[model samples]
Target chain A: MQKIILNQTWKGMLMEVKRSSRTKTAVSVVVPFILLAVMIGYVFGPGSELISFGVVIPEISIEKVEFVDSEIIATVRNTGPIAVDIVMADINDRIYPAAIEPDKHLERFESAIVRIPFEWNEGEPYAVGLTIDDGTRFEKQVDVAAPSIQPTVEMITYFAIIGTYVGIIPVMIGLLWFPFISKLSRSKYKFFLALTVGLLLFLGISAAEEAIEISSENLSDVFNGVLLVATVAIVSFLALNFVGEKLKKRAGASKLAGPIAIALMIAIGIGLHNFGEGLAIGAAIVLGEAALGAFLIVGFALHNTTEGFAIAAPMARTKLMIGRLAAMGMIAGVPAIFGAWVGGFVYSPLAAVIFLAIGAGAIFQVIVTIMRWIQNEEGKLSNSSVLAGIAIGMIIMYITSILV
Target chain B: MLTGGQKMIIVITVVSLGFAGYLVFPAMDITAQEQPEVFVTHSGAVVQTTGDVLDPVYTIQEVEFDPEKYLREFDYGEVSQLEDGTTLREFTIIAEDDKIMEIAPGIFYNVWTFNGQVPGPTIRATEGDLVRIHFTNNGDKEHTIHFHGNHPAEMDGIFEIVGSNGGQFTYEFIAGPVGVHPYHCHVMPVEEHIGHGLYGVFIVDPKDARQQADEMVMMLNGFDTDFDGENNLYAANTIPYYYQHHPIQINTNELIRVYVVNMVGLDPINNFHLHGTLYKYYPTGTDMVPSEFTDMTTFSQSERGILEFEYEYTGRYMFHAHLTEFSEKGWSGVFYAKDNSQPNMEGYAYGS
Candidate 1:
């Protein structure tokens, strides 16, 4: 009687397992499209709705002037958007023929340095004035300055060119490439678990370090205090938990959800980051940094693609409707859009920091989730291949550092 | 530790080296080197009126530059038209200590008075070199006399400056481009003084700008009027007005150069409209040809340019301010083109 009962129990358990494993046809068809639509909206949504009729103009009063190599470099920037269009230049009553453009120097908020390269005769102080020609006419003295020695070429070019690529592309491609191959196939669940772990580790270490560093720099032990640390940790965990649940729900049961989540989150993060990145690129282009921007594009593209795949795979199981799937895909892809917008608009490091934090958080969560899932599936020791891949990733990252 | 003498020697060496390095290989940029220099310049504001006949209350009589030598070498003349079907009249102006010998108190500030104001009585000239006027500003701040006409570079007031608190400068040039341009203070806080009525009209007579019957000088200037058009501040002093539009009126064949200068220290991308006609851009005081030049006209901030176009039909086209916000805050006006051939450049010069 005992043996019969045991057999019956085993049979029931196996039937349940088999029933659960069957992919729901309805879900497969509908969920993907839904997710895709959501992804798309998130990506190409609204940008800078915060500002209406936004027009930035930069005006400058020549603070100091120097003449170098027949070029006039003016250190001019003040409070207000610099919008003064340099009109004309005159020396002792003769029209001085020369070119006027922005100086190839980094400008901080409320301050900027512009270089107006012009043919110089090297004599009396030239009375330089620019006639702003937008809708108004503003004239200011152009303090001439000697041209600055060209910055270290290699260092600048490398960073300007390769920094962007490293920032976006490689990571994306790596993540995406993991699932498509047969032998290299990584289950969506496993990958997300691992990704979540990685992202968490990075964020935890980074945020902690950053907070501690800030405190130390100010000679304060308050941040390192148990209470503060605990608070931050708890807050971070709770936020992460909430976000994680939302992401999971969004992913649904379609194995694709894992990758889709990863992609969508990263893409959004990238979109935010790209805005600032775009500014850098635009500035670079203006300053003759085309090669650098190109290189960056490659890196960003690769990194973003991998990220997309990672986001898409986990949610793959649901087989959501095309619209939802497209939405998810777009959401995953949004980082690029956001990045591009920001890169074109606000050019600041503060922007960079905010994006970095968000990205670090999402990446951490995804990595951890992916890892756990993978470990469960393998039913063996934690995968060494992943470790190896991570190492490789690190090495690649280190190589890019060469450009920086 | 080194002895006191050794330390002193080291310190001295470092200091000397640092100073020397400042001259040779300066550390990026040396701020100390940006000291404001002492130079003669013409900088001040003046208000004036316009008419064919001079208003005895504001007629410019004498003109001189403090640093007389600069004046002797430079060109100085007014943009005016002669009565004999000619354009522009040549005259000399002296800007003395921000006060062109105060016009017996009333309402006057500039060198020559036009209808009793400093902007040297709005002078009406034509496209070609009709009249050349010389000006000298003896004011506290730097100033320039820009002629929105076909003026020569020597006469272009851009290089002229009146010293600070106690300085004088000379401006000389020929009027070529025909357009009604606003002449006012281009300094940092010029809007304050100008809003206090320190500006005038520089009428550059276009070949077709002659209207015998109903002619007027429309000057369109603005200040950040806070409460019911009251107090006005200059650039940096006045708060930014997100929405405000100022407009100027002009008739068909009438040349009007909206001398828009943002001395308000704010970012205003204003759009100039001509109701029905597509405004053709003309030369400002910056770039003017000797005989007749009109091609290479690149607009700049705080610069001047002529918007020329004739209306097909005689109608009061609403030339309202395009900037919606600027318009809402009393920054708007109308272009009542009464006649098809009536050259109307009246009221306050619409100097942006």
Candidate 2:
């Protein structure tokens, strides 16, 4: 009976082991399936709702404010990625029935004029608020609401005067260093040429950087704005190179013509750079974003003086006629006037990108030309004086740029 | 003797394999199911199911849209007499690009629209009428109404980009060509404009009108909800499977005229097919005479035509893109034809 009990115990042990193994096998299969099912549910479930909340981002930029005969006219542009409907306009937190010229609806990059007959005082502070269809309000405050200046002859003259101070006068002042540069030795001449190279290089790099930033930030993607900047820069570089090469080949026989051609190229490059600066200043005034004080003008004047020095360095040894020098100065400065006119009257980001790109390309091509000329004069590059001149030139530009 | 570490490793390997098998096997099954299946119909024509369905993968409350209303709707514009004794049709179309619409079930898309709806409005006018479009762009992007017909350079819509945000442009021209054409935003990157639903049918009747029939507009359009350049969903108006769910009702033996416009972007070509009957097709509706009698027709983007047919037998008929992929992906619909002489027939109710 004891033997029989031992056999039954062995059989029971065997059955217990089999049952536990089956349970383990079943768990191994089912647990993974359950976990996977849960994962799938989490990933492809209503819980992961796409675009759950309707996102409405309304943005409007108040470009200009004007007071015209008991009426407050505010020019606004829709700067957001979405369309905005202007439903109401308020003056000093009080709602007013405003007439929106054209339409109340503004698509992205579209502008509208809002006219509110509020009889606002000229010297009093007033806040203008525009309510979009989404209930988001954009407010612009005029600390002293005054009659805004329209783009008239006086405005054009004002822009031209500012451009002269910023572009021409300071450049002419830098050209006063011409006599001193002309007295330098051949080695010193090479150093000054390298200095001009440094200055042009700095200008080229900064212009390219600004063009890239503006194209990416301000312009629409449909324009392929960044690519536009790159393509325009490349195209301009090739174009200027072509023009420079043609000039160099035409004047290859005359030693005087070489310096004059280089000076002309330098003037064109500086002019393009000055044009971009003028566009910025003009656009700022038009948008009422700039505080154009005496300090700002002086700072710009000081900054542009370096550009004149760069142009003068290339023409130091050349016997240039006064008419030619005057012409070169105008070439390097007069574009500012045209730029200001375009920017004030019809400012477009695409135009800004293209002009800046052209400036950068011309400046870079001038650097290449100057380097080749230096190589021809000095038999080799990388002297201590040349390096020091480049360093000093860059430092001067950096210091002046800070003031601006 | 096996170490404890080895036992643990074995257990982990077994579990991981089990998990992988569980996930991978189903994925393989789904991939297999995605293959198109061919099925021969009773009429001896082979039809294939593309296996592309409105697989939402998630459920949400459906957005309401009436395809029937849009199908037959035509905007004649405010009609008046011009100073030259010509009929003047003035249409004020508002363009908006910031409209979020639920294109498919639970699939919302930011669609650029005209007067708040996709495919805009069907603009109808008699040939030689002075058609003036007072276009206002209220959207946050540049837009312009470019009519696909004979007009002056300035009225061509290209180069005359109307600004966004309360920008206005008056497109005035004499309507001609005596057929159906598409009018859409002529903005650069035109595909994005038309793809987002900133397009509509412009139908100009001949000097002499044709026989009056049940006229309807069937614009074949697609939506790329993911912005991937490839279309994910397609439909006869804007909604997929809408007409299938609510079949278009018509009287038997009545002349049915369908003004079909294919504005499906991204895909190179699309086609239309009718089950149970053939119809007379007029390519672009330019010619007065029918081009052919066929059960199917092909179309490139912006291609349109007129299809005229009469039902002899009263029943439900299927109309869809002949391309199986498009039809499976929400481009399918049905037409319910009933004899008016038969009174109170069971299951003959509209949309039944």
lDDT of each: 0.41, 0.78
TM-score of each: 0.29, 0.42
lDDT tens digits, residue span B1-352, model 1 = 9887658757965874565343222125333233321211112122221101111111222223211121112122443445765544566554333333322111122332222233334555545554555555545556555554455666555555555443544444455555546665554455444543345556555466433422333233334222223212121111111011111343555544333322221333333444666644544433333323332222233344544445566545554335444333223334555554556533322222
Each candidate: how many clashes? 220, 8
Error of 1 at B347 (Å): 26
Instruction: Give the per-residue lDDT digits (tens) of candidate 1, residues A1-404.
Output: 99999999988877887655455655778899999998777765576343446566544444335556645544433323443333333232222223333221223222333333356654344654432223122233333322332435554454444443534344344444333432334543444434434433443354444434433432123123334434434433445545666886976887765555554554444343343344445334333346776765654454344444444444444444456545544544434444443443332222333334444444454455555555555775356655654445445433443444
DockQ-derived CAPRI band for the predicted complex in model 2: incorrect
Q: Kindly provide the TM-score of model 1 when superposed on the true structure, using C-alpha atoms.
A: 0.29
- Top-TM-score candidate index: 2
Worst 10 residues of 2 chain A by lDDT: A93-102
B1-352 in candidate 2: lDDT tens per residue?
Answer: 8787658756865874575343212112223334564432212333333321112111112455557789999999999997889999999999998888766544557889899998799999999999999999999999999999889999999898898899999999999888899898879899989899999999999989988899999999997754656676789998876776567888888999999999999999999999878999999899999999998999999999999998989888999997877875678887888888655443232222
Residue range A1-404, candidate 2, lDDT tens digits: 99989999988887879988788889999999999998878876777874456765557866556777667877777767787777556676444445565566667666666776666676688888775654355678876665554679899899899888888888888787888889999889888889988888888988898898877766545446668777767767877887887798998899888888998899998899889888777766665555763455667678777888888888888875667777788899888777777667656665787889999999988888888888887877788888888888788778777866
